[model samples]
Target: MPKEIAGPEVTPGARETQLGEWRIVALKDASFALDGGAMFGVVPRVMWERLTKVNSDHTVPLATTPYLLDNGTYRVLIEPGMGLRWGEKQTAMFHISHDEGHELVTSLRAAGVEPEEITHCLMSHCHWDHIGAACGADGLPVFPKAQHWCPQSERDAALHPDHLRRASYRKEDLQPIIEANLLQTFEGETEILPGLKMVELGGHSDGISLVILETAEGKAAFWADIVPTSNHVHLPFIMAYDMNAALSWEVRTKWIPLAAEEGWLNLLYHDLDQPMGRFVVDAKKRYTFAAI
Candidate 1:
């Protein structure tokens, strides 16, 4: 029998109290290091580090929680985790390890859904960590029967990656899916599945994507890597991992309100502590974390 990878226990929050008919499954839990100065953008590390502890190596912990929406017909997986493709140097640099089985296949099976059953495998972006699990050990498409959806611009960028981003775009990670003919490229807002929409926002990476799930309760936006954690909910908490910080700020400003007003569940991809939550306007009218 495979060992179970423990996920963070859910705490009672506003969403559960109000919206009652949604189910969430944590796909994988993993971490990586990012420079402290870069992670906070212009903000001083003195201020930002106070909120969350940074490792000695300076990279903060990241999680990949791929939500499974079984709306009867569709079984969708939002961004899969960084898979087992790290070399020694990469592993040492990022401190990547999978003792608890960071395998999405195992996690999904435990959740009662098979890889072939997945209707859509949404690539939130082309970042190595975000898209690593999209392919498998043999460098082939992991989800054979599912359509791998990514933005057209992202696909183009991946094919002709720049010197700075080249290292992150490994052929082993993406080529198999392309060869398998499972890659389905999309432009702006497109509905790959009924009630599930892809919102195109380009800042963190070129043509970064977000998934919107229309549930019986309400709409939930799987904001991949944008607001990676609950701590990043603040407008100024832009990641150093983002290539274009200015554009990332712009996207956040626009989406934060849409999240607050409609009470949309902000599904964070790498928040170790608070994986999923709803944005709230506090007493001072600033956006804050209201975990679900």
Candidate 2:
């Protein structure tokens, strides 16, 4: 049984902040929902329920938050989008919806960027929710001129997911990008740009990675599904859908504290209301988030 509760409030738009030489913006895309129980993993419903509202079907709303990293010379787009590939059945099932202005291309245009202007497209993983907009309806790459990057393991997983994981991936999403000769796959920690790097942390999926950017001004980490929402700042809040729960715990244990102590700007991918924030450890030695 699900209890009636209010959904997280969302501020819809292009949220921007400047980190050193780069202008980082969280571009809105299709919003959807996921099973609350699966989202909270081992955490009890009574414990996680208070942090977020639940739909009648026990699903919690999630935001598809992709980021745009723009330095004067190069424009990097991370976690492309939830995309527009969902059919009416899937859309209704997931409660997916986005206004015209919230479309990836529209959001990019609103941020004063054109699709072709994107120099690099990075996907933390190839899960359909994360790389849905890799192509368009015409089966063409959306960022036609950009060099797309993904973890080699994730690329393989997306292309050939096992029986239990097949539902989370779609081959069509990556086929066009592959055929275009624009997709670049990496094995481990690789510096994609001067100050930007991808650190592969396998947990939620085999090849999910963390995108980190550091410059003279400050540092920021794009926490793919590792820490999808601010509510997941705690170390044990791993998602049940993760392929490797123990690995997720190990990764979160190491990174969450580092982000807090260093005061890095933590960019969340699925938090609907609070998209970006800083992890803070209080006097009580408990983790809390200071939303940005």
Candidate 3:
């Protein structure tokens, strides 16, 4: 939404797709902006600016997306976008926009899936953008019936935030879930539910984890911040936003090649263009993205 910046328009409602034995709905939430410099990390702007557009303020628009994995039994929602609770100042800072196609709640309703129908809300971490929507304007669980799943390490980090985290881990965003005592946390690689598993890959955050699922074609991974967007499909494109650029690089090196080799279903949450794709290795072993 937020006016596609030279990308195909995604339908407002959810579309059904098959991933082996699983049903997937790649949900759109909102379009927000971030500093282009931070997004590109050490990459020189002279190079990256050519690859993507930037606003007058040097901020780039990013997609806030969540993925729904349903196997008829479990309704799992991953990466619920920034909640609809931002004030004018915060909105201005983040440049959050609400195009009909990207409004989180409306998109969910339009998809014919009500909030109460979500059985599990698996969070990649407690980063404001990732966990903000677990609760809503009323400060109650938006998906009232869903159990909020996250990494215990992330919850602990959010609870005892340091200077580096103070800005990223917003207390107001997470208070409701904590007050409701609904948080269900896992340690490392955990199968929080049937057919759904997650493993911590600390790059974006201290406890940032990627969600994995069983797809019809092969294994699917939601590598969270490891590969936030399609642009990052290029191996060297790390973001300055990552807490551990080294760790992110290390993880990308390990997981990306496997994703390409094994034909894993890859989900890019922050990619404004396409959300689902597979990694392909060219004759020279260069990675490229092929949308599903």
Candidate 4:
């Protein structure tokens, strides 16, 4: 497990570590809850309810975690986070909670980073929660100086979502990036930076992608929503929110083992308890996690 910046005694707050030449910092934008049934897909409530606290509304708490990778020159931010544009209804529905200054930029500034310093903004997908902070309430790109990137499909989905995915994407959240000419889109897999790449996997959404960073230290993966939290580690534990459960299973089957065997430092996006850990496969071939 990577050491917490505040020391071992501190359990909550941002975590920082050095991965090869990059300085990685995990920042929390907001704490919210999602429908438990929607989150566990085909898994029985009996199996998952015991793993985490469930609110009276049957929602499971989750954190919107955005990671900042800095190596003096380029500062790349992954996952823009659920910004503060929700209305009363949406806020109440999600049980969103955060301190006064809880937006991604606020969290970035708290970590000694200003919005302008961000060189690139990477997206695993443009689901509202993952890309909400890309723009501000005034409909402008928040990180004006950063070149925002995502799969070409995600950009299309965000701009013109079908009935099924309409709610997951908000045009206002991504339009400004396009208008500002800051949005960069790719297909299949592309390395946006040296040692950093985004691989598109459409299981979660039409064009959702996963990020990979490799260096002398090792490989690190950002498992956006595929294996959202540590609890979703089971092979069958796909999320109902996924666009294609079968594809999600296949993706999980392939990557989970590779991550375990290769000893990649896995960064989770929605886990509330622990965001960073390494996959561990025991003799029985069952997978588990060892916190970093």
Candidate 5:
């Protein structure tokens, strides 16, 4: 049985705020080492290191593989964490460990969900770590029935990537899904199901996407690696992993208000301590993380 990890705690006597009615699930909770300088963009180490735990090697600890649920009809998985394909060198560099079963199959099974149960397999982008588990050990579609969605431009970039971007696109990790004829490309905003919508956010990676779920309570936007963690809520805390830093800032500026004004619960893919939360703007117009 999958052990239940504690959800974010609510203060005593605090009224329950219904951001949305979806049944959210945390699939896998793990960490990755990212260069501290890259994680904070232009922010100096002095300011960024205080918010995250940085090792002597200057890598920041960020969460991996968190997902959500929407009324049973839709099972949207944001990013599948680093999978089993990494060799010793890569593994050691990223400090990858299989002890927690961060494997997508294990996490999904633990949640009582089979691959086929996932109606839509959303990609934050095609970075090897994010989409590694989209295919299995052998080259085949992990989710046989689900459509692997990405923006048209990004799909093109992945297929015919420039030399600079090619490093992140591991052929072994994605070829199986492509050969299986399971990849589905989309442009702009797309509604995969009744209440589930995919929004295009380009920055961290090409064709980066986020899932927005509308329910009786309100709406929830799964911000995959865009606002990767609670620490990244600030506008300038862009990732070094992003291809276009300026564009990332543009996307974040636009989405922050849309989330707060519309009361969209912000679901994060890599916030180790608090994976999901709502964005609140205080009197000073600064954003604060309200754990859900």
Candidate 6:
């Protein structure tokens, strides 16, 4: 059994929803503020600022949200929010600010789970925010009993990074996990569990993946960074941080239409307002993120 850790009080809308065979719970952790221009990619600030409140510095607040998938037998955690390992300089650089007691581990505790109780830590990519909470300050896997899964391509990139965007992969995040022998890497669509599988949707990162599973209603998909926020459900709303902008747009246009048609409870990673919602196609054939 794992030791209990207290989490910050749950805010409104932080509850569980039943999806066929599984139950999904949305949990919020830390937040980081980033420039709106960078977040909106090619989209003009004038347009995005209108949709979201933009600060004088042209920055927008992003929520680092995680999800807990409970099927009564297993508990799988997707993308534990940015860990609380930043020093003064890093804190200032990333504009990292967390709620009172809502760090990743604490958020899990808030959900009545301990770190060791997590059976799977499915990472979408090796981005710091996505993998930070996997390791502790002393460089050890936080979820000692869980099977930590990472894409082989992402592991290679993080270990041997190139010049561009190298800072995004933090050593503290990967080194500890590797040392603990809890890390498992895979290629293509892999079935970590019977109903849960990771689909390669590489646009944001070379090896980023989207975790999808069958639900009683339809299907639930964690599209990862391809659609970080519900607002990014729009075809062109991609982040400039994507390594391949063309691929991002291509993938989004292709799969999102299918998602809307089939009705997926999309769990977003960075949407401050809405965490998970369904998509509906209007008469214009445009996919809109409908709050459920």
TM-score of each prediction = 0.89, 0.94, 0.91, 0.94, 0.88, 0.92
For every model shown, the clashing-pair count is 4, 0, 5, 2, 1, 1
Which 10-residue window of candidate 1 scores lowest in summed lDDT? 1-10
> What TM-score should be assigned to candidate 2?
0.94
lDDT of 1 by residue, 203-272 (tens): 8888998888776667777888778778778788887767888999999999886787777767777776
Error of 4 at 257 (Å): 0.4
**In model 4, where do residues sit more than 4 Å from their true spots?**
1-14
Q: Which prediction has the highest lDDT against the true structure? A: 2
Residue by residue across 47-88, what tens digits does model 6's lDDT show?
A: 787788776667888888888998878999998778778899
Which ranges in model 1 have alpha carbons more than 4 Å from their true place? 1-22
Residue 288 lDDT, candidate 3, scale 0-100 = 66
Question: Between the candidate structures 1 and 6, which one is better when assessed by lDDT?
Answer: 6
Better of 3 and 6 by lDDT: 6
Whole-structure CA lDDT of model 5: 0.71
TM-score, prediction 4 = 0.94
Worst lDDT run of 10 residues, candidate 4, spans: 1-10
lDDT of each: 0.74, 0.86, 0.79, 0.85, 0.71, 0.80
**lDDT-based ranking:** 2, 4, 6, 3, 1, 5
The model with the greater TM-score, 4 or 5, is: 4
Q: Model 3, range 69-132, lDDT digits (tens) per residue? A: 8777877888888878889998998899877677777888776788889988888988888878
**Any idea how many clashes model 5 has?**
1
